[model samples]
Target: MPLWFDSHCHFDFAEFDQNRQSEWQFARRVGVSGLLIPGVTHARNLQLEALCQQYSWSFALGLHPYFLAEHEQMHFEWLDVALESSLACAVGECGLDRVLAVDDAHWQQQLACFSTHIQLAKRHKLPLILHIRGCHDEAAAMLRRARFEYGGVVHAFSGSEQQGKAWLDLGFCLGIGGAMSHPGAQKLRRTIAALPKTAWLLETDAPDMKPAFWRGPANSPAAIPLLAAMLAQLQGAELNELSAQLERNRQSVLPASYLIREEPSIN
Candidate 1:
């Protein structure tokens, strides 16, 4: 089995509510040493903390823009408490999403929320795991202006090489997921091939962005090796070498103390 790290996932989501423990065990059997769970909203902070304790995986806590309707002012205060807590690893799942038809007022509010996450991350010296969609330019601008020290990956990245280059230059890793597994994803496959190993991170975005092969049901982190194999083939690199590179890239961003165990030997 290839040693791997799923840099992003939502194991706390209801999809695995019934058998979340079994899911983690399956991931372990498949050689996934560690997984990072990003908090999608305030309500999930406690749930995610419990998940980290239960599964022994790290987690990030923040407000997701998609749930802005439910995010009240009090949530920020709650966020402060969550960030101060030992269970929190990073701050995010926060960023712009133009596809959701957000009004200008709400959009600005999201930006404010995003900025708050950045500030809290800096204060606590933890990395951030971002969720950027249709608004890469705006997100990049905000990231550039902030000049944050601890950086993180841009989850479910589907962007141009130029955009990717900008993020890479800004100390961010580009997260590749099941999106590139599709035969129709030529552009994304090309980007995956072009990205330097150092600038790449692996993710599943499970139960949401299902890969090409697994269509009907929600995707799971266990599909990492399948996608990693696909990505390796696209880059014309051997599976072991590619997995090693990805593992190193993941560890560079993930907390050092995370996933301490006997990792599978890639070679």
Candidate 2:
């Protein structure tokens, strides 16, 4: 079987609190060799770090825009300190979201938080684990203006062809998850299929973004193989090849000490 890496999964969430180890072990046994657990809030970093150490998975750190209202100016300061000392693989799952229910003030806070993460990423020489939605063009423009160079994953990306190209130009890999497997995401699927293999990575975004195969109550890392098979089918390539490229993409963007890097078997 092909080795796989879940480039994004919130394995630290409470949904897995009942049996995180067993679920993770199952995923590994089925060829999900590793996963990247992204940070959404400062309070969860310690718990996430402990889990990553125990399970030998990679992780990132940042405040998510989805919860911008809960964030304070001091959170950014705390993040800066943490990023300086923590062994985080990247600096974000943070970015702009035009579809938020927040008012203008919260939106501005989102922009500020994203900018801080960008600055932190640059300062630490770490890439970003982004969470952009409905504001790809604006975010891309901001990144350009900031001269951000370190690359990372664009989680659950569903942008237009031009927008996808913009993120690619900035050296980021677009994360392909259960959403991409949906038949209705015609434009997203078509745009992704056209991009080079290096531009894509696999994720389940668990305890969320359940694949089209089943509308399960919650997603999990174990769903990776299913998503991988779907991605290979969409890309019109062999499963083994897709597996190899996805691994390569992850290592390229988010290198962490815990991850045991192995050479890709694809030619």
Candidate 3:
């Protein structure tokens, strides 16, 4: 069986609280050797750290834009505390998202938060775990300005070919998840298929973007192989080759401490 990595997810969420261990067991059975869990909020940050400690998997911590309203200015203090204690693999789940709205005031706050995380990643010489939706251009521009020394993966990326290329130019890997497995996601599937193996990493974004087969049910890491098989078919590569490339892509963008580095057996 091919070893696989889930480059992004939220295993600390309530969806996994009930049967988290069982979920992990199924994921291992289905070839998911490891997962990268990115933090979304204050509550989830600590929870994610604990989860990582328990599973010995990798994780990242940051404030998500969707919950921007709930954050206080002083939250940065807590953020610092969390980062200090965290054995996280990276420094985000943080970035701009113009999908809903972002007035100048909130936008500036978001930038400050993002900048802090970028600095943290640099200080630790770790990769970043990002989330940029509907703000690719702005995010890219800002990233250019930030000029992160250690690049990372852009979680659940669904941008244009141009945007994808632009991010690739910056040395970031595009994360492809269950979202790309939907039959109706023609553009995403096509884009992912055409992307160079070096530019792609597999993720599930579990409990959120469930694959088509598990539409009504909660998404789990167990769905990784299902997504990977579809991706390999689309990319026109052998399953083992795709899996190896995916693992390589992940290790290249994420911190080495995230997983046990092992040689890819191409047999």
Candidate 4:
């Protein structure tokens, strides 16, 4: 079976609270050898850390934009401390979100928070795991100004081809997920198909973006192969070949120390 690295997932979410262990085992049995869990808030860092340690999974720490109201200036300080001390693989799950109609003050706050995350990622020499939605241009502009040295992925990226290329030029990879399997997502599919092979990373963004067949069901890392198959069909490559190439792409962008190596096969 082909091995997979789910570059982005929220295994820490409450949806998996009851069956996390079984979920992990099922994912591993189905060829998902690695998983990256990203923190959404300061309060969740310790929990995320404990999960990563328990499962040997990698993770990123940041303040998500959707929860901006719940965050404060002190949370930024807390994030900095977390990045400095924890074994986090990156600094994010942070970025802009225009979907929410907020006043200028809130928007500016989001921008400032995102900028701080970029600085933290740079200082720690780790990549970023951005969560951008309808603010690709704004996020791109911020990234260009920061000129972050370490690369990262735009998790669950759904943007124009130009936007995707802009991120790639900024040394970022596009996280492809269950959305690619949706027949109505023609534009996203076309954009991904046109992008270079090295520009893509596989992610389930589980318990959220479940595949078309499993719509309304909680997504899991075990569904990675299903997403992979759809992506392979789009890319016109064999499933195993696409899986291997995506793993290489993931390694190139993410922090090497945080990556969990697969155990040796028994005779």
Candidate 5:
């Protein structure tokens, strides 16, 4: 079977603490060769780094928008330091959220935080892993203003065709997850069908975005193949063919240095 990559997953989260070893094994057995673990806050950088280093997995370091209450300007300073010292692949799991930021001040804060991450990614010459929710146009405008060079993936994409094209024009790939598997997600499914195959990158966003079959349960990287299958069905392509194309898409957007390495033995 062709190897698969979970371009976004929170394997560092405590949900995997008790069974991480078996989880990794299950992922490997299911043809998941690699995973990208993106940090949501400055505080988790150490833990995220350690997990990636221990498993030879790739990672992205940035401050997520939802945790605004927990972050401070000093965190950006720490993010700058972390980027220089660590082997992170990109600069996010960061972006704006319309619902999350209720007021204008809060929305502005999200914009500022997102801009800082964009600048950091530009400075580091790394791709961004954006987490846009209900603010695709806003995020697209910011990206256009920044004129960012390094491309990235927009994780958990569920937007209109126009919105999808906007992000594509900015040189970003869309991360497809369990959302596409839902029958009720007809609009998103139509968007996926309308787009070219190169516009997508498969992800599980584990411990979240559970697939239709596994709804109500914590997700795992092992479910990536199922996600890929759903996407392939929607795109009218063979599983392996779509998998190969998605891998190429991932390589195109993410920094070359983010390539997966062999995992170290648990013992």
Candidate 6:
């Protein structure tokens, strides 16, 4: 199997609680050498930290827009502590969303929380793991206004080619997940094809965004290779070639220590 890494996975989610160990082993066996688990709620930091540390996996600490209501005013201080410590390698699963933002007040709250995550990422000198939805323009504007220098991955990117380029211009990458495998994702596939392949990351976003080819009870981190295969076909490149480029793309934004194990030999 070609080497692979899942740049954004929620392996800590309850979906795999019963078989986390077995599931992870299966992932590794399938060539998924690493997974970057991002925090979605403050209450799960330590739990996420412990899980990642236990398996020597990489993780990040941040408040996701989906769970903003659960985030307390004081969690930012706690988040700072984790970021300053050795607990995290990145600073988010943070960004704006249109579907969740029911009103101006909710949108403002997402903006505020996303801004805080951005500032935290800047302060710690870590890349972000953004989660932008329909508000790509707004999110890109915020990142530009914040002068976010450290580039990161934008989870589940559904933007047009222009929007993808905008994020790329800011040193950010678009995470390609199971969604890219859907028959109806022609636009997303086209956008990926148009953008430089170097500006993408492979991820499962497991327990969610299950690929069309997947018929399992839930998505698994192992879906990375499937994603790689799809991307390979999209780019009309060999799997090994795509794998090597994916590794390089991820490493450009994240440090080596974040993903464990030696990378697959690239030739």
Off by over 4 Å in 5: 257-267
Please estimate how well model 3 matches the true structure, expressed as its whole-model Cα lDDT. Answer: 0.80
Q: Give Cα-based local distance difference scores for all models.
A: 0.81, 0.83, 0.80, 0.85, 0.87, 0.86
lDDT value for model 4: 0.85
Candidate maximizing TM-score: 6
All models, RMSD in angstroms: 2.9, 3.7, 3.6, 2.2, 2.0, 3.0
For model 2, the run of ten residues with the poorest summed lDDT? 258-267
TM-score of 3: 0.91
Predicted candidate 2 versus true structure: per-residue lDDT over 1-267, tens digit per residue: 888888888988899889787777677667788888888877876567777877778889888988777777787888788888877889878998988936788788788889988999999899998998888988889999999999888999888878888899999999988888777988878887888888898889999998888555789888989888878887898999888787778778876623434532232
- Model 5 RMSD, rounded to 1 decimal: 2.0
Scored by lDDT, the top model is 5
Q: How accurate is candidate 1 locally (lDDT)?
A: 0.81
lDDT tens string, model 4, 102-206?
888988888888899999999889899999998899898887888777879999999999999999998899999888888799999999889988899888898
Model 4 worst lDDT window (10 residues): 258-267
Please give the lDDT score for candidate 5.
0.87
Q: Which portions of model 3 miss their true places by more than 4 Å? A: 81-85, 102-104, 257-267
List the candidates ranked by lDDT, beginning with the highest.
5, 6, 4, 2, 1, 3
Instruction: Name the lDDT value of residue 10 in candidate 4.
Output: 90
lDDT of 3 at 144: 85
Instruction: Provide the lowest-lDDT 10-residue window in model 6.
Output: 258-267
Query: What lDDT tens digits, residue by residue, belong to model 5 across residues 30-69?
Result: 7788889999987887678777888878999988888988
Model 2 clash pairs are none
lDDT preference between candidates 3 and 6, better one: 6
Whose lDDT is higher: candidate 2's or candidate 3's? 2
Model 1 lDDT per residue over 1-267, tens place: 668788888888999888777767777778788888888877887578776877678788888888878887788788887688667777887887887645778777878878888888788887788888898998889877887878778899999988999888777888999889877999988887787778788899877889989754778888888888887887788888988888777667655326637753433
lDDT of 6 by residue, 173-208 (tens): 789899888889888888888888888889989889
